[model samples]
Target: MNNDIDSALARFAGAEPHAGLAGLEDRVMCAIASRSSSSGLAMGASLSAAAFALVLGIVSNAVPLAEARAVSTLAPFGAPSPLAPSSLLLEPR
Candidate 1:
């Protein structure tokens, strides 16, 4: 290895290792983390808001709600269920 290259690498790895980028890293991480957290919080909040609205609609429409909703069904109306939990693992006895 050339002495010049060796010395340059040694100094680079030994010292701050690019002072400008190093300093910028902390600030960048803080900004990124903050933005990510805020975005996540906003998304979660919006999901919660939508869920609340759905529940409110269901509750308010309960009286006029379809009676067919009482029975468990896999289809929109009624049909053989392909996705229902199977009791095949239970003892036949």
Candidate 2:
């Protein structure tokens, strides 16, 4: 079945003169090569950097005792002591 269709298409195509693209293929290939050579990159790096910045900001502000290093007590992650004064208002009276 496919052979008959192939023969019919070959006969029909052979009956016509070949009308080749003057420079369209070359132009299209050049365009593809140029695009691949000087390509646009996805924004994964930018997004990762933004996420890192956001995490840093959140960590800096999230822990209330983040800056309390003077107190003797220490959390499991080596964080500041809960008894330490992170703010001026929390200093010993």
Candidate 3:
């Protein structure tokens, strides 16, 4: 095993240096820049979506407990949902 290792080392020492590929550095740099730009856009979109969700949650939760109870009491059977115009129309006496 020692002899094999020595022979391998000797072969490597005698080998010529490898010529790197042309424009490899430029291509790698361009790929990195494109990935970075795309990641930045993705990060911005993710943050925007998170903020929108948070604001929506806050706004939805800001309703008073009494108001929530009142709304629930008004539609206990889930009929005539809140958005139905018929629910808001008052019957004439």
Candidate 4:
């Protein structure tokens, strides 16, 4: 049974190709090449956009921003908290 099936498959595989099959490989290859070329263009465009954003970020950081200052003077607090070790050491034993 295996030999019979093998012989039948061999006969089918040995059959000649049809006329419409001509240049099919070339057409398929051309389609694949066109798709790859479009993807390459899209990749380049995205990379260009990323580079522009990076440059913009660097340039913005290079410039100095405005400085902020306190509007009113600060008053002195009476003493350091007794819980602090330094304050405890300063006190008479």
Q: Give TM-scores for every candidate, taking all chains together and pairing residue i with residue i.
A: 0.29, 0.28, 0.33, 0.36
Candidate 4 per-residue C-alpha lDDT over 1-93 given as tens digits, one digit per residue, 9 for 90 to 100: 579889999998999988899999999999999998889788999999999999999987887586768675544466555556777788898
Model 1: residues >4 Å from true position, as ranges? 1-37, 64-93
Best model per TM-score: 4
Once superposed on the true structure, which residue ranges of model 2 sit more than 4 Å away at CA? 1-7, 16-20, 43-93
In candidate 1, what are the lDDT values of residues 1-93, reduced to their tens digit?
Answer: 579989998887888655567679789989999898779778989999999999999987876655555455457446646544453344364
| Clashing pairs for predicted structure model 3, backbone only | none
Q: Give lDDT per model, in order.
A: 0.74, 0.74, 0.79, 0.84
Model 2 Cα lDDT, one tens digit per residue, 1-93: 579889999899888655775688899999999877754453566788899999999987987664555546467566656655573467667
Candidate 3, residue 87: how far the Cα is off, in Å? 69
Regions of candidate 4 where Cα sits further than 4 Å from its true position: 41-93
Return the top candidate by lDDT: 4
Ranking by TM-score: 4, 3, 1, 2
Which 10 residues in a row give candidate 4 its minimum summed lDDT? 73-82
- Cα displacement (angstroms), candidate 2, residue 49, comes to 12
True-vs-predicted CA distance for residue 36, candidate 4, Å: 2.0
On a 0 to 100 scale, what is the lDDT of residue 30 in model 2?
94
Judged by TM-score relative to the true structure, which candidate is superior, 1 or 4?
Answer: 4
